[model samples]
Target: TNNLAKTACINIVTLNSVAFYIFIMSASLPSSMRKLVVKTLTSNFRKAVEIQTVPLPNPASGHVLVKNHFVGINASDVNFSAGKYDPSKQPPFDAGFEAIGEVVAVGDGVSQSFIGKSVAHLSNGAFSEFQAVAGKSILEIPSMQPQYIPCLVSGMTAKLALQESGNLKPNEKVLVTAASGGTGQFAVQLAKLAGCHVIGTCSSDKKVNFLKSIGCDHAINISTENLGQVLKEHYPHGVDVVYESVGGETYETCVNRLAVKGRLIVIGYISGYQQPMGVATTTSARGAAALPVKMLMKSSSVTGFFLFHYANQWKSAFQELSDLYVAGKLTCMVDDGSSERKGGFRGIDDVTDAVDYLYSRKSVGKIVVNLASSGSKL
Candidate 1:
């Protein structure tokens, strides 16, 4: 009888404690600082992107606070959400890298000029409505348009991969896999600008048309046409430069199709991003072989590219791309499905759908998500 009475008292005390904690938490959250927080990590990326209200953080010394206007959806974002990109990033880790916004506040040791300036940056925690970023990394932009967000990563990557790493020569036969993708589209245009004969591969006729419109000399629909056959017949002499992102069969074919002294740039392998990490398996279809023998026999080279590794080149590269844009030589193709809706995929609610569209292999260009409802037109 005494033990039963003690148990009842303990249960009541526990319930009171829980209620008090909930009340305290509720009272602490300010209405203005609401943000999303990833509550859990799941195999389904959409389910993994959970929405929670978090307190907006203030910038620290050497950092600026940004009110996010737009954010970009890269293939890596999906992989990050799925826990396949970085093992250290377990549940509750914030995802997203590229974003455009206006500086609302500056921290100690930061210049006051940063306030009220429009900027773009590549950083973690971009999935939220507000972020504190190192002021030195911010790039001043003309507006909050999502179009400029790609220039933060994708454009710079494409330029450096071809002009610096690949060393593409005029009239060189260049092939780009996933040509209609965010980074791939930039590669197609940049290769053409370098006077290289650019060929791009996609899965749909819609993307094929988009590629051609962007100066691609040839577009191969991998879904309807055989990538190997097309390369064998048209590029019998082998390709001089290959900007490969899609892995698996596409990667194997690119290795086999390299010309003597050819250069193949490895940007990513989106085809395997959703599969098991760092393990050889069936569903992944991530395979390639004869690399050492093939490279030695042909004097060809393969270079792996990670954009952040070339941080020093960002300023100059952005200047060059911006100049091209002003001169009408560079184009920024952002897919937000705005045509289907008045301002499609605006707000955090549509991020899941935006990511789904990217992996669907249907989008022909960069997939951008607008955080500000008013900035959703692009």
Candidate 2:
């Protein structure tokens, strides 16, 4: 606990120990002051949020203030919001990752070029009105930027995943699982731009057409048709690169389909973060494919990617992608959501509705949220 909070808690316990002392303390405060003190005390997060003032935070050098315009609600935000992840950090920390904001207040020892330009970064806690982040963490938005914010996130992430893991070459077949999801949709489009024959896997026939519209040369409905058999029909020889986004039984199958000397990029494992069904299960499909022993013999590579780590470490590479986005060689998808609800809807609220749309496996684009902006429609 914070020292101030600990001291306040201790004061409460001590106040109760002496009933007579409470009366003495009550005498010390005027009636107006007592009321003011009582009013400042909060009962919940909503109460704590009821405010107008932004505290004057003392930022060290290399930090700049960003007046934010957009923030993206990631699946990781959902996991963090639902309290499903381990070590459960206390509530009241801001939740969000990718946001587009303009530089406003810069701390000492930084460049003047930073002010007035828009930027995107990897750190969470972005679901707020303003932020102060390290200079290196923020990247200036490209020339051909979209009017909306989430596109910056999708474009950056898609380029990063493909370049880092697969190093995809022209016309090499790439298999993207969870092909219609927020991130997977980007993978499909980028793989095609790189001159790869992209095959995407979705949950239904409805999304299959959607995937094909976005540069997927072939699509698979994993719920009905078998992924292994479908790949056998399309590539025949074997898949050149496997972009493993959905993990579980699907992970096993993706690993199995890798061609000899093919690469498997372990991009994401959404299955690992999901709530359990009260039982354990197993799968065996993927038979004798992409074995660890065989991978070593063939000199094949398997790389694990986490965007949070890479954006901080590889700043130059991230900038190159920003340039690609402006070149129009890359395309991204967006689902702005329906306006059926209240005053500007966003975040986990939209996700709860979008999850059903996603579970139905019909959504064919990157999921986005438009946070409350009065007078604007969702």
Candidate 3:
């Protein structure tokens, strides 16, 4: 049998005349060298990022030093780079949020047994070769492949948004807009798993087929079909739960299609992320009455959901998602599309290109960038 584990090699890289070593092996336990991905002060999603070798720090007490094997790319990564997440935030900062890695070293008070365990993490510095994550943030997994990284963010977010935010119930009618996206794909499957009849919206026929393959009950090509008409004619009673992300007109449509006592969970508004940031006006300004009034009339509710804010329950959510995957109830579809400049984003250097491809809004599933991994053959 072929062992999928690949060996990691140490590389000496120079940044501004200073040379630093990346990925120090146990034999060379200096613990003073590391590598990180950074962006300049004026850099945005439209600009390129830099990979620089820096002084690596030993794991702090109760923390584990992990050698990252794979990192998950999210739309939030683009928003963070574009200065939309925090306008006051300056550059020369590390990017990325979720990753899967193996514990190469442990800090004071941590067990040495963690050294070889593969785990998933949601830490601050994931877009690099290594991350010293606090022990509590790690979720032990069976594989270190880049594909599993999406389960940390997109998967957990989808599970929580439906179960916690939407209060999903079996046999209910559920609707997910942007249903072919990272989180949306998971939402579609999870809703189906819960015995809900799912209606997903996508922009293209390819994505429509992708959603259908994943067990989505009804896939609507919003680019070609009239969404409002489809809902009115086919689902006159409206849907029970709406997992909404794309805002603006799509949000309005979802709101209008809410069944009595229905719940609408707002995850993000990707429609406005690329545009100039500004204060948002109420629905009444568009000649439509207040959305709250409409919700009140139907005895429905609208709530917002942000996964990071519910950090305490992340592990529990991941546990359920992992079980589902292990039991063959959940599947992750990864989009391997390339940008105009690169054939495929197989290395860290192609992150910017990957982000650009995501913004093009053409991918059908989770978009991931594979990191070169070096480990003992299993």
Measured by TM-score, the strongest candidate is: 1
Against the reference, the lDDT scores of all candidates come to 0.81, 0.61, 0.78
For model 3, how does the per-residue alpha-carbon lDDT over 1-378 read when each residue is reduced to its tens digit? Answer: 133222211122223122222234454544454344547433255463576777666789999988777777787776666667677877777778888878887788887667778999997768877788998778999887556766888998998888787888889999999999999999999999888999999999999989999999999999999998999999999999999888877888888899999999998887766555563522445524577688889999989998988898899998888888888888887775543334456556656666777878888788876666322211
Model 2: residues >4 Å from true position, as ranges? Answer: 1-60, 78-92, 111-115, 142-154, 204-206, 276-301, 312-314, 339-362, 372-378
How far out, in Å, is residue 78 in model 3? 2.4
Window of ten residues with lowest summed lDDT in model 1: 280-289
Per-residue lDDT tens digits for candidate 1, residues 1-88, read 9999999999899778766754554354344544445556554567777776766777899999888888888887766776765667
Score candidate 1 by lDDT: 0.81
Model 3 score (lDDT): 0.78
What candidate 1 gets wrong by more than 4 Å, as runs, is: 1-43, 83-85, 279-289, 339-342, 374-378
Cα deviation of 180, candidate 3, in Å: 1.2
Query: Candidate 2 lDDT, tens digit per residue, 186-254?
Result: 788888878899999888787887897777898988889988888777777778888887776777766
